[model samples]
Target: MEGRLENGQYWQGWTVEAPVGVVVFVHGVHEHGGRYAPVAARLGEAGYACYAVDHPGHGRSPGNRGNIDGMDTTVAGVAALVTMAADRHPDVPVFVYGHSLGGLVALTYLTGERHPRVVGAVISAPALDTSASNAVQRAFAPVLSRFLPDLGVLALDIEAVSRDPEVVAAYRADPLNHTGKIVARTGAEILTAATAMPARLRGLTLPLLLVHGGADRLMPVSATEVVRAHAASPDLTVRVFDGLYHEPHNEPEKAEVLTEIVAWLDAHLPPAPA
Candidate 1:
């Protein structure tokens, strides 16, 4: 289905219906929600009503490719998606599944917003820290974002996306995936979010499950430690898969990684009505 936000941005949504619970998948940068349809299908088979949406400027939604006005806009996009799911299935527990940049968005929403139906969040390879940019790129991104927001500043390396060659090739061939350099403002917003997220996570009090690839090059595994340090979630669980790349769910050990996710969700899911 499709929906338009108050800011005049249009978003495309996909759903796999079930009754036990809801899992809203938040995709990474340069990628759209459609890329996660397979993952959502898996969750649906586990009895979850899965939901995903393409952020404005990233997928079927219209905007300059590979750019967003700010992280706030992307965060709001997910918030709207979650609200739509909750409104459609009231009383069904909602869980967030975020990967990479989507991880940052999910964390921001959980800590900053108030949504009672949201039971917990599962974030995989969160982009809390980025190793892709150098000191020079980081220093200049903010200034360039103000002066030339649309300028492409950093390019994503497809080879670093996964350990499996097939996954990397498929990602490269996907027309919906933004294969160009990230825009100045988008890069700046991501850097800013990585820096500010730890502090905001202190306010996170919900059940949280964080998983990451031990060898992820794009976003370092050390970033997860920052969440471990600051997030006040009493039920936080962290798992690191050694020898994997940025996209753990798309990695070679995908089954094990996904099984771990479902197990966590099953454990945390609210008790079914009597």
Candidate 2:
């Protein structure tokens, strides 16, 4: 569950044994991979192997709270885990399931490298861009970070800090989750990712399933809508679940959500190019 990489960075995750292809899950900011236990069990019961990794500085992964810069290191770390997973399951289709920040990290994993040769990907409310907070963060972060570099003073109030009681409750209950704290550098990278969403969408030829909650306040559906509208991938599909929040997989109808993910993964990820 916990191990240090050859590179010295500590990583944490869950591994489920199955004969079928392996599905590696990456959780978002503040949350850990354990939150995906039920989904992993569901998929495992259905015969698919699963590996869920906590991002650096998240969950049991070793690092100070909210210290991953630029997200590239996190993506590379994911590639490392995928490589290890591949060594165990040779030639099997490797699929990635990422949520919010994890989704972006998944995208980051695929963007500039060809390490794992992932078969397909599932992105739930991937925060490709920070929607509309870039302008202010870019301008004000320099001033704020000078005084309070560790104040978690990034843009976006996030739904957790809003008037929404349910969102706050769920966030508070998750011990693996962090508070409203993102470094200015991290904020800049998020902006870069959001800005590149259009180009990424055009070039992402991999089979992708983008799921977004219709009621999500933090990661608005427009991000998914735009990607679905413009993605050049012939196999891209978007699912908008009614009444779900930013995290549909962890929502009340998580069973239904996992069912849809498993079904989609089953349909797209064939055994292999035998």
Candidate 3:
């Protein structure tokens, strides 16, 4: 079904079991909810209703293409999604899963005061530390943001970095597949998350699984290393996949990662109330 949030963003999602737990997905930059269909469908097959929403200006959601504006808004959107999906499912816990930029947003949301009702979260290839994007963005950011909230720049292009050629090709072929108009402010938000990660690392309590690709060029592998180093949550687990690129869950070894995720979720989230 298609629905619009109070924030004016739209979502395309599906639910399987009535009153069963919910899983919401926040996709990374330049992509949409459609990319998560395979993963979400698998989760549904496992008895959990899954949802994937395109963030503002990305995917089917209405806005400029690839311009997320900031993490705070997207985090709010995730919280709102949990509340709304919770309304539909009611009796079960709702988990939020995010990849790349989405992972940082989920982290920020989970650590804050008004947390979502999730028993656990799965963060794949998270952007948790500084890299080349950090330096370039900070050096030339303010000037660009002032004039170009949406300037249609290519950040490595979707095709160049994906481990899955078909997924990369599908994105390039999609009518809404956008390589243009990434908001400078959105870039800034990602940096802020990268900058503040250290101080905030030890405060997380929610069950979390951080997955990263050793060969990821967009977000450094050190990103997960930093999080694992300072994490106060004893329940947190980190998995680094060899030879995988940015989106580890979509990599060739995705089945292994998915299996690990399902096991993590099963242990953390109790079976639906009988």
lDDT of each: 0.85, 0.72, 0.75
What is the clash tally of candidate 2? 2
Report the poorest 10 consecutive residues by lDDT, candidate 1. Answer: 8-17
Model 2: lDDT of residue 102: 84
Q: Write the per-residue lDDT of candidate 1 for residues 167-266, one digit (tens) a residue.
A: 9999999998999888998889989998888889888889999998999888888888888989999999999999999998899898898889989999
Pick the winner on lDDT between candidates 1 and 3.
1
The pairs that clash in candidate 2 are: 30-177, 129-194
Model 2's alpha-carbon lDDT is 0.72
What are the TM-scores, per candidate, against the unseen true structure? Answer: 0.93, 0.86, 0.90
Q: Give the candidate order by descending lDDT.
A: 1, 3, 2
lDDT of 2 by residue, 1-274 (tens): 5666665555544455555677888788777777677677788877776776667667767766665544677888788878877776786678888888888888777665745558788988887656456577777755654555455755344463324466567667877776756765555566667677677667777888999888887788887876787677799889999877888876777778889888998897665545
Q: What lDDT tens digits, residue by residue, belong to model 3 across residues 235-264?
A: 888888888888877778888878877777
Q: Which stretches of candidate 3 lie over 4 Å from their true place?
A: 18-20, 114-116, 134-137, 152-154, 271-274
Model 2 misplaced stretches (Cα beyond 4 Å): 8-18, 132-134, 140-149, 154-171, 271-274
Clash count of each predicted structure: 0, 2, 1
- Highest TM-score scorer: 1
